[model samples]
Target: MQDILGHLQRLGMSGYEAKAYVALVAAGRPVNGYEVAKRSGVPRSTVYETLGKLVARGAAFEVRGAADATDYRPLPPEALLDRMRREFDGSVDALRDALPAVAGAPEGHLIHNLKDGGALLDRAEDVVAGARRGLVLSVWPQEMARLDGPVRAAAGRGAEVSVMAFGDLGDLGGPRGGERIYEHRYSAPEAVLADLGYRLLVVVGDRREAVVGGFGGDGSAWGIYTADPAVALMAAEYVRQDIALQILAERVGGDELNRLFATDPGLLRLLGRR
Candidate 1:
């Protein structure tokens, strides 16, 4: 009884109206104001007014009663529910059509924050999937596993795809069949992650949009996505520099790279590894 009253109130009924309507429904017949007040525990003072509101809302119907006293009967539950559903859907459709014109155009560069791993990845996947001209990405192996499909799809559609990947992503079968893939060799991915306190993931699409995210060791994640040209270009350059670093590492060799990492404090600060 309490549950039914609560549900009715949520559907836009006042407390008295909900109780009175429930009383009418439970009575399963036309009931007078006095009887409704008694069954529903609504104050007799407001019961008639409440019943009138229900009648106005079509949740109840007024009927003639003995001695000209008015009585009310509940609309059948199925009919009442179906009517409400249709009304609600109609309102939603109208808003969907009308609200956008009122919202107007984009004011400026847009940046949005994604507060969890799922949302961050979802936005990254959207950026990758929507890329038309090119893609630049820097991904930890963990995130790359999730993004592999979108990356391949983008590349297969003729988008120039470049990936600067940390950690060995075994089974991707080297070179990813054609996309520019740069495997970082300066330090272990774990060491870099430990120094930074999170796994960083970046995706830049068409040099026009980017998603930069941090997936942390403590199960927390956060990220930002933007169409801001400056930010996107910066992220793209970050990946490009990484690809260039990989090329330099190959030419300089691991021994020389390790010597620089150990000897140069500035290099340690920049690389976030030692």
Candidate 2:
């Protein structure tokens, strides 16, 4: 019983409130401050104060009797939990509504030159960390390793993640449970190699908005952060195109295509096989 009081306190209940409520529930009757204090091991002088606090917090109710005595009764455990949940949900909604006017902010854009070394990696992380909805990306080993944390963070936040990589991008392993991964040999006839030359892109989009970035080896990167319907539609189209291409290539001849790709020494080396 004492441990139960401590458990309630650990769960964010005030010590006196926890004690008073536990006493009331155990007595299974409307209990006066003196009886509550004696049973709960609370100091007699502070028992009424504790009961008052419990009443204020909705953990217990005060009932008036004909003889000028007031009795306290604890709410049921499930009732208390339900009320707490409702209060928490209401608080969250209110906070969200108030935050926009107080610390509200807008979308951000950043650019980096690849020659900047580790800074390029940091910039990629920043982009992925801020993403919502989904991420569609094509990247190389170095860049992929750098952005791994941020990518997982996005996925943990409920963003859909699909990654296409050339060479090793760390085994498609991540903490977000799972990720949709596409691996290809960069030396293939396709101009859009998973790595080298072209650029690294991370696009996050929802039904109404999107954020897109173009990053490349030259240390040059560009971003368009927008919620405009037209921009989102155009960006979504490209995402659809990429998904389609991945499906097409995989379906056309996954094993045969990979075999042909392996023949290229440069690609095999990039893929860390040679």
**Alpha-carbon RMSD to native, per candidate:** 9.5, 10.9
After best superposition, candidate 2 residue 163: deviation in angstroms?
A: 10
Model 1, residue 52: distance off in Å is: 35
The parts of candidate 1 lying over 4 Å away from their true place are 1-105, 173-175, 258-274
lDDT of each: 0.89, 0.68
Best candidate per lDDT, number? 1
lDDT per residue (tens digit) for residues 1-274 in model 1 = 8898888778778999888888888998899999999999999998888888989999999899999978889999999889888988898899989999799688998999998999999999999998989999999878988899889888889999999888877765254644788778866787888889998999999999999999999999999999999999999999898789789889999789778887899998877875
**Per-candidate TM-score against the hidden true structure:** 0.58, 0.46
Residues 160-181 of candidate 2 have per-residue lDDT tens digits of: 8777665556554544444676
